[model samples]
Target: GAGVSQSPSNKVTEKGKDVELRCDPISGHTALYWYRQSLGQGLEFLIYFQGNSAPDKSGLPSDRFSAERTGGSVSTLTIQRTQQEDSAVYLCASSFLTASGNEQFFGPGTRLTVL
Candidate 1:
């Protein structure tokens, strides 16, 4: 079966440009997540979606960052106004469910560079 997939493996944009990253989760998985990894930094949880429940946007850095899962399968992360601080590798993951301890398969991620 196909695992998580992301588009535009690498992206370079000027400091105020908007960028949209896409993710396609594994078939039938009910859980989806977005994470960001910056240079010389660790992975940071961004947002998550599970089934029909409301998404958890607690981890979103700011209001400029947002995500949505369509048909419970594919997801997209949009950055309203890109900044140098927003430059990082945005990773997406999915799982069967979101329990206390569930396995999450990750996507390769899209590296966004802000110039």
Candidate 2:
């Protein structure tokens, strides 16, 4: 009955480095999603994975962004060659179903800062 959790809660790194963020989805939720929200910006979808379906990565900002979900539960978002432009709050959400507008519960998020 635990909720989703993200690690570090804050990260700062030099530009052109790589960073990995972790997400722990709620148990029994079949759908998981990743999103990015910069300061004063709206949440933008990055990637999604549902039960036995192809992952959706269309919302990823660029080739530097990628993610994967394993065991239908936990997911990790890895950023290659981090840039200052990539600094943002990386949020993770999960839901019972894959329907659009589903009420997804979000984690506190890992705040990434690329300097």
Candidate 3:
């Protein structure tokens, strides 16, 4: 079985430009998550999607950041008007939603650099 995967492992973009980061989760996994890790910082939760439900987007930093999951499989994080502060490693994870807890499987992040 395939694990979570992210595309464009490294992205270098100019400030004010827009960037789209993609993630593919494991098959049949009911839950997916997006996170960002800035320099010297812990992983920051950006969004979460479960099945066909509306996503939990409370963790998104600003209006410039948005995400979408299609057919409960692939997800895309779009950063509009990129900023220097947005430079970070964007990580994706997937898991089964269980009552007790769900262990997350992570992907090699997409390193974003806004110059």
Candidate 4:
């Protein structure tokens, strides 16, 4: 029904802390994605989910980052042992199918500030 939504909008934590970010995609849309963008940087793909297909986790930056999608709708990304380098706007996006040629709607993102 609604467009994509993310929580907290902003976050601050010391290095090595764990954090979880949430995403809610639009109804009837079978495709979802997560991306990260540093200030003045391009979008960094994190993950994608579509129907029953195995998620594409290749974009995850490190072992500290992980995510999951349930029922083809909601998704969550957990970053373990956060780092100051992880500071960035973690954006979430969704589309009608696996990205590539498909346009994605993006969320405002959870801006994580790792100090």
Candidate 5:
């Protein structure tokens, strides 16, 4: 079994471009999470998906940010009309059954550079 994985480990785009980051969580894990780490800032929780439902989307930076998990395994985070400030590393994590304590396994992350 593989751990969490992300594609296009690094990306570079212009300020107004839209970007889609992908994450593949551990198989059979019921809980998936998305996080963003900006330069000089701590890791920020972006969203969470339990099965196919997202119960906590409050952490999305704005309406331009959205994510969805399909079939309880894979997820994609879309950032529309990206900005320079949006440059950051997007990380994904998954846990078995529930997302509690230190049980979550995190992906290496996708580094997005918005020029």
Candidate 6:
């Protein structure tokens, strides 16, 4: 089976421009997550989606950031009015949620550069 994958492994855009990053999770996985890793920083949780329930977006940095999952499979993270501070490696992970806990499989990440 294929693991999580993100598109445009590298993205370069001018400040104030918008960018869309895509992620495809493993089949039949019920939980998906988005994270960002800035230079010399730990992974930062951006959002989480599980089944048909509303997504947990508390981790989103600001109104400029948003995401959506379609058919419970593919997800897109949209960053509007990109900023230099928004430059980072955006990672996607998926997992099968179980009572005993689960491990998240991560993607290579989409490196975003804002200039």
Name the top lDDT candidate. Answer: 5
lDDT of each: 0.90, 0.88, 0.90, 0.87, 0.92, 0.90
Candidate RMSDs in order: 1.2, 1.5, 1.3, 1.6, 1.1, 1.5
| Candidate 6: residue 29 lDDT (0-100) | 86
Prediction 6 global C-alpha lDDT: 0.90
List residue ranges in candidate 5 displaced over 4 A.
Answer: none
lDDT of 6 by residue, 1-115 (tens): 7899999999999999999999999999888889999977778999988964535799899999999988988999999999999999999999887223789999999999999
Error of 4 at 72 (Å): 1.0
Candidate 6: 10-residue stretch with minimal lDDT = 93-102
Model 3 C-alpha lDDT versus the unseen true structure: 0.90
Comparing 2 and 6 on lDDT, the stronger one: 6
Candidate 3 residues 1-115, lDDT tens each?
8899999899999999999999999998889889999977778888898875545789999999999888988999999999999999999999987233779999999999999
Best by TM-score: 5
TM-score of each: 0.94, 0.92, 0.94, 0.91, 0.95, 0.93
TM-score of 4: 0.91
- Candidate 1, residues 1-114, lDDT tens digits: the string is 899999989999999889999999999989999999986678999989996454678999998888887788888899988999999999999999988599999999999999
lDDT of model 1 at position 34: 92
TM-score pick, better of 2 and 5: 5
Instruction: Rank candidates, TM-score, best first.
Output: 5, 1, 3, 6, 2, 4
List candidate 1 segments past 4 Å from native. Answer: none
lDDT tens per residue, model 5, 28-115: 8899999999977789998999999999999998999999988888999999999988999999999986636749999999999999
**Candidate 1, residue 82: lDDT:** 92
> Which pairs clash in model 5?
none
lDDT of 2: 0.88
